[model samples]
Target: MTMPHKTIPESNHAKPVNLRIREDVRVLIDRAAKIRGKTRSDFMIDAAYRAAEDTLLDQTLVKVDAESYQQFLDILDRPPSGAGFERLMNAPKPWQG
Candidate 1:
């Protein structure tokens, strides 16, 4: 008798990634994955995710808990201060011609 398998739920926000690497780099990737007992795709995805998380943490981001989230929502509910906006809007454009 065969055992029944459960189906995994699908994700809605999947994005396709395609990258080109040099031949030497491809060889190095295979070697690294073999040493770690992980597939090339797994290693690459893990590395990319770590790099992405680091980048987001280094930027101007507002992180908050549930209570703070409500406060944040209320803050955004108000109008903008027009901070640095006028300078950018009225700034002279460089000559492109």
Candidate 2:
């Protein structure tokens, strides 16, 4: 007599994706990954992360109009000095006064 057959359980989750790339790009990715001693996925993830960070930093960086920027540069170049500096530094403290 034949033994009873048991069916294997089937998974409903979809398999992870695989990307098909051009041969030259694939070679380039492989070379870069090898140079860094990382897998292609790790290299790509790191590169993407860096690109996002750079984009965000560029966006967040403060930019001023030419006139305003020049004024800022002038102020920085000609910082106050002499008695003004001394008075500001030697000003009486609220607790002392």
Candidate 3:
């Protein structure tokens, strides 16, 4: 039995982006899009989105050695100190007056 395909919902796209590519690159993209049964725009949008996500994630994700990771956890566990505690204690509350 053939199952129905799930498609992304259509949204109002008001922005226009102009892309410049070599003819050979365009042909390659067209061929790949045809093979995947997607229009060139659909394929490019999906590929661009994936690339953008990976770029952002690469910047945000971090790897640390076990000792450094333990140090990080230790810092988080440390209590607020000195000036910060004094400020909190002296700060005026709206409920007081």
For all predicted structures, in order, the TM-scores are: 0.45, 0.47, 0.53
Candidate 1: which pairs clash?
none
Ranking by lDDT: 3, 2, 1
Global lDDT of each model? 0.77, 0.79, 0.86
lDDT of 3 by residue, 1-97 (tens): 8687445456797467789999999999999999979998888877887788779988996889999999999999998789989899899988999
- The whole-model C-alpha lDDT of candidate 2 against the native structure comes to 0.79
The weakest ten consecutive residues by lDDT in model 3 span: 5-14
- The worst-scoring run of ten residues by lDDT in candidate 1 lies at 2-11
Candidate 1's C-alpha runs over 4 A off are 1-14, 60-97
RMSD of 2: 19.7
Question: Which ranges of candidate 3 are over 4 A from the true structure?
Answer: 1-9, 61-97
Per-residue lDDT tens digits for candidate 2, residues 1-97, read 8686332234597355578889999899999999978788767766766788779988896878999999998999996899989899899988884
CA displacement after TM-score superposition, residue 55 of candidate 3 (Å): 0.5
TM-score, prediction 1: 0.45
